[model samples]
Target: MISQVRSELTRYLRTETVGGAILLIAAATALLWVNSPWGDSYFTMTETVLPIAPLHLDLTLADWTKDGLLAIFFFVAGLELKRELVVGELADPKRAALPIIAALGGVATPALIAFVVGFGTDGMDRGWAIPVATDIAFALAVLAMTGSRIPASARVFLLSLAVVDDLVAIVLIAVLFTSAVSLLWLLAAAACFGGWALAQHRRISSPVIYVPLALIAWYALHEAGIHPTLAGVGLGLLTRVRPDEREDQAPATRLEHLIQPISAGLCVPLFALFASGVPLDGKVFGQLFTDRLSLAIILGLLLGKTIGIFGISWLAIRLGIAERPADLGHRDMFALSVLGAIGFTVSLLVAELALADVGDGSAVELAKAAVLVTSMAASLIGSALLLRRGRVHRARHEARALQPEE
Candidate 1:
């Protein structure tokens, strides 16, 4: 039985696309089950306190997932983002422009729209920033199941765009969301970052050397009024392996490879399980549709994302800043843009920040419900459209290929 379980685990891990999908499914199921008749137990399970020596640490299962497990996800994300900036498509200014432009436009337009809609409401206006994040796991999963049919360039474009989106989201979280400023704690955090840098300079690649420093950095940031997870970004940027002088080889490539599986395989899956399970019960249904925050999120993610990505992309192509991707014309881009509307994880994180301790406690719940609903709708609609378009495009290409006489 142990051997059988090991074999199954190996298979599940091997299929990255399937693994992501399964994780998402598990999250949704957990949410539904917990919100249903078993909700009391589910709620209790999350709220149950787990203890360590001399420290009374309290968390709901949800907090453990978000505050703890999701940090690992962000760490992995930081790793990937760094690698791309250093060596991948994003490394090249020319190649990176199209996606960077689209991502910026995508982010800017949505926030603008949200602000307009939520105008005159002081902090409620702040929530516009929440819809700006694109959940990379969900996006990648959508792309992956579509298989090799997508142009490699489009996939690269989407990945780069999402990375930029995450960057923007991080900045907004740090600047806009933070309420209190603790100078001493921030100084300590800086000291921890400096120590982490020193260790990296000495080429200490083991996670052990970094882990204690990371913990300190996290605690410091927590105290310093910055969200603790941003420490992952700090730790990632500071640590590095030297670049290979040989053009044929990569410097940080191995490190990236080493951490990616852990990030994608374990950390991300756990995050999906933890971050995603909102109690989607009958009570949630009323709040999901009518709440101002919920309405704004749903519309922003569904309408704002689709329009922003596609609209800006078209303008860039028209203005000659970018050429239409060789295999993808406007129609294809539109379909993908809709898929980009699937905002899940980052949206949740932003909602948590936006509604932190705000009145009625219902705003955050409503936002989560909106995220869950709109993201699912966006994914389904986007997938159906892409599959149809891909089929047609494939048929056309195959016909051209077969027409040898021409």
Candidate 2:
């Protein structure tokens, strides 16, 4: 059973690697479409509204991608978090402390840098959360391409840190961005969550029964003025992580197995398509360096994230609050920290939420462009560092293998 589970995880990681490449393609396509002669049509398609009058669910194509499809991604994320907290690497209090501490640093430093950079700038301060995210798919893909000699522990560390980063981003979205709340609908959403938990406790395995309940919870949360993607997190946490003695796999594991491909392939790519379509003309490029918002995002992601994650991690290890993995060195940790700055997916979502109420979308456009450019820059820098490190590790391993026998 353990081997089988490992096999599944390996497959999932491979799929995510491919999915990351596809996501880049999708984002590039969106950018091209938006900047092409037919750019207005791209806007028109995204803005076309579809409304379910009875449920008060009205959304555009872009909204569906963000609020609807991205829920699948968050649900998968929540499942991963639950597994880690319950029986995975993070199951141990000591093992979890390092990544948790580093993730907090990762979140705080970027927000502080962004706030300081955008403090006096108009409408830029709202996007303080923009650099606090790390695109797991893209980062992992870059790591995988860095070569096979990279320590497995490095990947594990990166995954744990990214999960915590996502958790922080979710909280920011729920608390910092929400403008209003409706108690009645919020209560309804909570009730739905209760029912979902009850069903999980009862060992209800049928998707038919749970699907409608999930939709109801989503709708209620939407009406409650909370980001409905959070409904996915709530349901996922409530999933059963431990199987009954008679069963081989837990419900959460099974659900993750079923949903991960969908989330990676369809939902995330679709979200990237809609969310990354910034019209990058000459004016946007000219303002990329001069604009406070762009500078904040660039510095926060490129400089602040690297410094924060690595600095806090080093502090934690030095103080004996956390232990570095035996297989990983300071350089490896620093490379992973650089990868943490590739904050594409959630950062773009936060930029949209932050600038939603602003009349003109110039600030929004600038933020989106910054996220794209900075993420790419981080990826390149991280990949270079990891590649060099991988070669050194590989050479050391080969040298050890060639040592004289006793």
Candidate 3:
């Protein structure tokens, strides 16, 4: 059972690593498209509005990428979270406490830092949530590249931390960023979720039944003024985690296997393509440096994330509230904490949401640029640290292997 779980995790990591590479390429393409001669076309394409008046749905291409495509990504995330909680590392209370505590610390510290840095600055304080996110795919890609020699326990810990971080980000999006609430639509969404739970309880396995229900729930949430992507999480959590006696596979696991590829390969990269394209002009460049919002974001991600994650994790171990994995040393933990600083996908989403009503597009553009710059720097610095740690770990392994038999 343990080996099977490990194999599944390895497979998932490999898929995410490849997806991260594609995401980077997509982001680069967006940057290039925005800076090229056809820059106006890129903006035009994303800003083009499409409406389905009958359904009362009206959104731009960029909005669809964020609200529609990213739901697939969050659905996979919810599956992983449920798996961890139900049968994986987080199933054990003692084992779960570390990453859960670490995740909370990670979120709180960055948010606090952003708030402090942007305090009293116009339109800047709203972006406190931006630095609180950790991009799992991108961070995992860095780990795959630099820390392959590290133990599987490190990967497990990182995955757990990232999952919890995403959950917090989702809550922040639902609560802090929501503009208004329509109680009727909210109740309708609740009914859809209840129906979803009922279907799962009855072991109804037909997509024909569930898919439309999911769409209705998503639409209801959109109408309720909450981020509709949350419907994905709701449906995913309602999925059955225990294997049927006959099939020996949980519904959550099965659905994850089917949908993960779509989320990682298509939805995420598409979202990045639309989200990362910011027009670069001299004015934007100047704003990137001078703007309080940008500076708060950069510092919050680069410095605050590392400090918060590492500090809280250390405190947890020191206080006997959590125990570090035996295979991971203090050095490895610190290195992983540094990697946690890579806040790209969700951070970009938060920046857009937080600053949407604040100013002209320039502030949003600057915020996006800050996220790009900080995430890149975090990737480089964290990768270098992990590479150094990996080499040390490999050397230790080799020395032990070379030792004479007892």
Candidate 4:
């Protein structure tokens, strides 16, 4: 029995979705622990002072995870964006149209809904971008809970949609979220991108060589009124090697593979732990059912996300622009569409941006609480529906197989 149980545990661990599940669990655990009676200690530990060189950087341990560790997360996101543009789904326009179109609708609808909900409010309007994100880790966790039930195309569709979602989220952060604009520094960043492009064109093989220049670019953008992280995307986009005529490519794919493990294993999880820490105490629970930003976020994810994703997807299929996977029908798509709102990671990132210049942490905390609640609810409902749908699909298939004559 012990050997059998160990073997089963090993099999579960080997599953692709299991890692995502573990990450979500870790995030939830961190949130719970940080909000408990030991919460003050948790806060202190995260906020403890640490110095690097002459500059002393002090942040709650959470801030380090958010600002410091999340750089690596964005770096990996940059890598993924590069890969998708080069050789993955985003490479070909024809194949990419469906998800891209659906993603646009998905992103736009949520933002619009958020704005509509917060219309009369002053500062709350800035948080329009909060609900427009889809957390890939949580979404993947939803998919993985299905075991073998989810079709390959559905999985691909979800991933492709998320790629486009991430793209839009990046643009929103760079454009709408930033306060001031610095033309001179922006020009310098542009020049750095141009240089990186030239190196990629010339088959430059040194990642080390780009480090200082990238940092310079980062500083330029940071000073230029753009978020420093946008530079990561810009640098990634500029330096990424396209899979064209060259026989031996430079550092693109190799760098991507090397970074994926770090991103998935450490950076992302740490980000999750930091980002997910919304103190869910008595006051927070009260706000969950009443606060405008919280209500907007919750309703946007619960109602708008499903409508946005499924509504656009239905239109696409109706217009013959795209079709669902063979193993997936409208019912299955609805099930999957519900999961689209599990916007934990991306929502938190956007929340950070939305609440950047606002009142200290209140808006961020409200957004986090909403995201946490709605995303958890979406994941649970979506998972249950998909599992049942999968079982029904299997039963119908088996019944047809057993039929002697039609």
TM-score of 3: 0.97
By lDDT, the best candidate is 3
Segments in model 1 whose C-alpha atoms lie over 4 Å from true places? 1-19, 51-59, 120-123, 245-252, 281-283
State the lDDT at 24 in candidate 3: 91
The CA lDDT of each predicted structure is: 0.73, 0.88, 0.89, 0.74
How far residue 72's Cα lies from its native spot in candidate 2, in Å, is 1.0
lDDT of 1 by residue, 227-312 (tens): 87788876776655334344222324454456656666666666665655576667788867766667777778888888998999
Candidate 4, superposed: residue stretches over 4 Å from native: 1-19, 49-61, 241-250, 397-406
Quote the positional error of residue 167 for candidate 4 in Å: 0.6
Q: TM-score of the candidate numbered 4? A: 0.87
- Candidate 1 local Cα displacement, residue 50, angstroms: 3.3
- Model 2: which ten-residue window has the lowest total lDDT? 1-10
Candidate 3, which segments miss by more than 4 Å at Cα? none
Error of 1 at 63 (Å): 2.2
lDDT tens digits, residues 136-191, model 4? 76787678767356666677677778878888988888777777788998899888
User: What are the RMSD figures for all models against the true structure?
Assistant: 5.6, 1.5, 1.2, 5.9
What's the TM-score of each model vs. the native?
A: 0.88, 0.97, 0.97, 0.87
Candidates, ranked, TM-score:
3, 2, 1, 4
Model 1 TM-score, 2 decimals: 0.88
